[model samples]
Target: MNPRGTRLLAGRSLLVLFMAATAVPFLSLFTTALAPQGSTPHGISWPSHPHWHNFVDAFNAADLLPLLYSSCLIVLGVVPICLALCAAAGYGLAVLGFPGARLVFGLLLLGLTVPIESLITPLYYQMQSLGLLNTRWALILPLIGLFMPFGVFWMRTFFQSLPKELLEAASVDGAGPWAAFRRVHLPLAAPAVSSLAILLFLWTWNQFILSIAMIDDPSKRTAAGALGAFQGHYGTNVVLLSAGALLIMLPTIAVFVVFQRHFVKALLQGAVKG
Candidate 1:
């Protein structure tokens, strides 16, 4: 065979390999979601019957709207407080020269090592004491506080890397500390904050255990928590399970599509500065 023919065959093989590697996982997950639950012992595969109805049924079988409400409520509970606190804490850590500022920053970083699973028991008791369990506030308040630690750390790193000149220039123009942050810092930090918001929002939205434990009422459940209903109702209906997984993935997909531009911008900004 000619060398050119060999080269053409090798290139075709390489292209096929790349496409399979990239497409297979997503395609497998999607096929599994649509597949009848027990079709293959444990491996992901396509359904024998394209159970499109399962997607619609999954929505109908549960009080999905309330679940969606609870999910939104969780996002609502966690995102704003975390964002505000991070903005404030990050700004201070990046700008202020307080005594023990590094120490404070170190303590905040320590909070990251404390796993959510480890704190659940103690947090449960605390929520019980406040009579907040089974309510939206129960989930919101602790998540906000617990989530703050990471938010501060993330924002601080991003903030510290920002041009110090911008803040100083604002100060020179007679803007107060708060005014400078409102007028200048936030606009520039928009990319970082938006990226941070995307991560935190996804975390809060997909949280299952906390939502399950804190809110005893099944209706007061996040979309992840609602998956329990799928297991309960469908049990062995593999197709339904597959569809439900796909359904669960959609909201997060939408969120990323929206905020993805900001996240990309943030990375570009951070990379250039570094």
Candidate 2:
């Protein structure tokens, strides 16, 4: 084979190996979840009789409805507001070029480096001072703040990559920044925004530390957050736990599968153009 063919074969082999490695754990989880209730799953072994109802049992046992509701509530609360604010911030930073903009952008960059673990303690205190702790507001408010840096960064990078001609054309037509954004840039930004929305949805759904730490009530916490307590209560039942874990993960997996093309396009376009 030629050198190019050899390299292509090597790349394909690597991709197959990578895909297999990633699929193993999920395959194991699915098999284990099908194991009989109360039976300990030993590795990836299939059960003699698969019990698909373990998911139902897990759902009922964990009282997952409230957890799901709380997760949805938080996601609904966080994603839109965060997206809007981030889009506006990104546009201002990338297009407007106001005074002190670099300083402000620098602070946003600094936010990306700060670890969540470090912020939790101070955030807890701050929330307590505001009498917001133990409520859904506790989760919603802190999460918005936590997500801002990355969200702003993502949108700003995309905005920077956008062609200036679109904005200029809008201006020549006597359009202001707001009108230009609404009419021209916003439509073009669909892919980038969708990508950001998917990420925010995934992160918000899986947010455990903040949900558990900020909210005292397990029912009020996110699905992933409430899973800790659910696990504690059902720690002995591996099958149920496995089923419940998969159930918790279903939404994120579904979202990714649905929007994967857009997600990939956004990443590639951002890397190439931004």
Candidate 3:
């Protein structure tokens, strides 16, 4: 029983405790989803006769296919464009050091302080005036804008961490800024970009407020947003509601499970670099 061994044991115990805390809600949801329809199940008791078909019923009732399509469309529209814009802006600010770069970066930082909830009313009206309301564009366009502040900040921080010698060497080889960026930095930035893409995808996919506020049609809203309507319709049917909730959560969970390594790598990279 060395001191180090005691600390390791303590840390492992804490980790297991936190893991169980994280898993309890999902376990409860799963059990409730399997409960008999229209029956309010207490706690996390397993149903004697689990209604597996509730998932199918929830899917149909929620019309999840169109919602899924809309979410995918919005993600496609938002992630790539946001990544490009943020990366370029970050490069310009960190590497190029253009005039007023600090001022511009400061403004982006200020934007991060602004709450999304505060913009909802004005955004709704703006979308209505522009005739983008009730369409996927409403969600797509606003998300790109909303994500910019954090995206640019993340990219800028990563770019600043890169060795300046790399850029200098590229220049010595007669490479232009665009060439250096495309050939040298972009490849190095894959992990950061992949991590950012995962974050934007998760945010866009789970965007409930703007999806419901801007888009009137349930099918056009994000899967998480459409859940509000599903909840409204099946609020009394706790089983169906739970099933629908789990269905909506499936894609995000799957994505995180798949790309979690990249996400963790980027985070660790930042910590080490910082």
Candidate 4:
């Protein structure tokens, strides 16, 4: 065989192997979700007593709506606040040259190295002092603080990637720093901003430890906390558990799908072109 022919065969085999490796896990999960707990699949395997109602039944039993709402509230509050601050900080670090910029940014990276678990106690006490514990604000404020350093670093890197001459030209044309940032820089960084928001939104939504620690109230628990509420002393309801897991993932998946309008190509295009 020709050298090129051998290489083509190798690439095809590698592609198949990669696809199978990645896809099989998700396929197994979907199958498990559709199947029963311990019943043998004697005849049909698709679950004809299909337990289609399990989805709503499991979710509703979990008192999931308010938990879902609490999560939404937390993400909604955290993402925008973090984005603006991070973008501004990043822009400063990237575009505005200042003494100790590296020091400040390096410190942020340092903050990133410290896990959120390390600070939960101090954060809880701080929230207690502010009368914010067990409230959505408790979740919101900490999420913003914890997510900030990375957000700033990301936005700063994006801002740095832009041409300096653009900002200068805008300034020469009578644009102030705020105006340049808002009208010019912000528009160009829309994709980066959107991408960052997507990531932070998901992280805040899925945060389990903080939700469990901060919200001791049943009514105020986040989605992950609500899942823990589903267990019994007898045994785990695999169906209900899986269903809850699926529901929690639904909003996140929706966010990604919806934000593809503002993300995916836009972010990639900005990164590649800029």
Candidate 5:
């Protein structure tokens, strides 16, 4: 076999290994969740009598309904606003060639280095000062701010990869900057926007720390945040805890499964452009 064929075989084998590695934990969780309640199941053994009711019990015990609603509310509030702001900022920085854009972009890039853990205390105080604590706004507002750096960067990179002639062509046809952005670039950016939306949704949904720090009520907290309290209450019950975990994970998994095509397409587009 040639060197290229050998490398292909090796890569395929590694990919299979990685897929299995990623799947094992979730497979274990599923089997444990199905095991008899209050019973400790080892490894990934199938239960002789699956306790499917564990899921229902876990849902009720964790009060997941309200938590799910809160998560959806936060996601709805964050993703669209973040996308709009990022897209506009990206367009200005990458395409408009405005003065001092480099300095502004560099400042925003610094935000990517600041850890969320470090901001929690300051954010808590800020939210309190604004009287937004314990409300959905506590999560919604901070998340938008926190997500800006990476979101802007993502959209900026995509915009920068496009040919500048596109905008010039739009200008030749009597379109102004806003018109060019709205009619030309925005349409071309659909894949990038869709991909960014998926990422924002996942990040917002799985935001555990901010959700826990900002909101006192478990019901108002994001699904991932509520898991801490749920585990605290049901920590001893491995079966029920597993069930609740799977329930918390369901939304993210469902979302990825639904929009995975867009995510993959965006990634492929980036690779090809690069």
Candidate 6:
């Protein structure tokens, strides 16, 4: 084969291998989820009886409705506030160029380096002292703080890469700073903002450690976090566990499927800008 054709064949082989590796685990999980409720799943064996009702049973058994509601509540609380704050902060750093902006960016960069695990103990005590422990606010407040570094960084990069001619034209048109940001830039930033919101939602939804650590009430914990306790109580039921896992994953998968275009666009924009 010619060099180009050889390279194309190699790429195709790699893609197929990657897809198989990714798909196999989910396929195994799906098969296991379909197995009779009480049976143990042994590595990809086809179930003699596919128990489709296992999903319903798992949902009810896990009391997943409350957990799902809690996850939604947390995501709703976190995403908008984080986006608003980050957008303003990023615009300030990138476009406005306020004094000490570089210092603030440096601090945020430092925060990104700090692992979440290291803060859990201090956060637990801090929340308790504030009497926010066990409340959804506990999760919501910290998550916003925790997510700020990346959110601000992501938005700042985008804003920095924005064509200055647009801002200049807006200013020439008698637009003030807030007017330019609100009327001109914000609409243009829709894709980046939407992508950030989706990421924050996914992160907040999958927040396990903080939910399990900070919140005492199982009813208030996120679906992923509650899964740990659920597993503890029903460890023997592999089918139910698999079903619950899939159930918890469905919302995120659905969200990505719906907004994937925006997500891809934002990523492509970022790559090109970077």
User: Which residue window of length 10 is worst by lDDT in model 3?
Assistant: 265-274
Residue 174 in model 4: lDDT: 100
Model 4, 1-274: lDDT tens digits are 9999999999999999999987676555455456665433332246655666667776677778888887777777888899999989988888877899999999999989999999999999999999988887888888888998888877887888898998999999999888889888899998888888889988987888888778787557668665665654213566566666787778888998788776675556554332
What C-alpha lDDT do the candidate models reach, one value each? 0.80, 0.91, 0.91, 0.78, 0.93, 0.91
lDDT of 5 by residue, 137-226 (tens): 999999999999998888888888899999999999999999999999889899999999999999999999999999999888899999
269: Cα error in model 6, Å: 2.1
Question: What order do candidates take by TM-score, descending?
Answer: 5, 2, 6, 3, 4, 1
Model 1, 132-238: lDDT tens digits are: 99988888888887888888877777778877888789889999889988888888788888888998988887887877778888777678877876678876776
TM-score of each: 0.85, 0.96, 0.96, 0.86, 0.97, 0.96
Model number with the top lDDT: 5
Please write out the lDDT profile of model 3 over residues 1-274, one tens digit for every residue: 9999999999999999999999999999999999888788999898898889999999998999988988888889999999999899988988999999999999999999999999999998999999999999998999999999999889888888899999999999999999999999888888889999999999999999889899889888899999999889889999899999999999999999999999999888881254
- Backbone clash numbers for all candidates listed: 7, 0, 0, 0, 0, 0
Question: Which pairs clash in model 2?
Answer: none
* 3 against 5, candidate with superior lDDT: 5
Screening candidate 6 with a backbone cut-off below 3 angstroms (N, C-alpha, C), the clashing residue pairs are: none
Question: Candidate 6: TM-score?
Answer: 0.96
Considering lDDT, which of the candidate structures 2 and 4 is the better prediction for this target?
2
lDDT (0-100) at residue 30 of candidate 2? 96
Residue 39 in candidate 6, Cα distance off native in Å: 1.5
**Over 4 Å off in model 3, which ranges?**
271-273
Candidate 1: where are CA atoms >4 Å away?
1-25, 36-49, 271-274
Tens digits of per-residue lDDT, candidate 2, 64-155, equal 99889989999999999999999889888988879998999999999999999999999999999999989999999989999999888888
